[model samples]
Target: MIKPIIRLLLIAALLAPGSAFADTEYARVQFCWAMGKFDHTIYFGEVENREDRQASFDDLLEISGIDHHAVKCNTSDSTSHRLARAKLLKDWRDSEFEIVNTTFLSDLDY
Candidate 1:
């Protein structure tokens, strides 16, 4: 089990947007890919299935002005996922962006 202080420090570290990856186009793709692939019921509510989840992610990419087809999620880079996940977590915690909430993803016509 993680100690309280350690957990708090971890949270604090994630909350800090110190990495440039948070704003990169590659990170955007990684973020969208993760949103599509993961179970985000706590935030965006439930998706109908895997297809719907992917469709939602596609819609998100479209809405964000990104080309879904052109994106090549660099799965080899662990740092990229960490940075993207951190950015997502930070946005969720602070409610800093529209993309991080249920309303934004749910409202998309998937």
Candidate 2:
């Protein structure tokens, strides 16, 4: 009984610090867009919490072949919203892909 308890405590001690550190080191990225006819916007983003798992924005651009400098929109609406968008943009900018223009085509049922 005593040996099992000691082993459990040791394991917990070794893993506790790593779990806490991981929680702090992870970062989140999101992609959001609005489509006509839908009540809410569509969003897709990645959360990169690990150093090795984080994808460079430049790589994303190269793969997609997009220019990042052409994006021109006021993404700053609120503090929380701004921060979330910034994180996504940072990843995109790092990959060298810029948003040019976003147009939404309406699909209303007549």
Clashes of 1: 0
* Model 1, residue 62: C-alpha shift (Å): 11
- For residues 36-98, write the lDDT of model 2, one tens digit per residue: 122222212232221321133223433444433221112212333345455544543454233
List residue ranges in candidate 2 displaced over 4 A.
1-31, 34-77, 103-110
* lDDT computed for candidate 2: 0.30
Candidate 1, position 110, lDDT? 45
Task: Find the 10 residues in a row with the least total lDDT in model 1.
Answer: 68-77
- For residues 18-108, what per-residue lDDT tens digits would candidate 1 score against the true structure? 3244433342222233232232221232232122344565556557554323222222123555654565455445532223344346435
Worst 10 residues of 2 by lDDT: 101-110
TM-score per candidate, in order? 0.25, 0.24
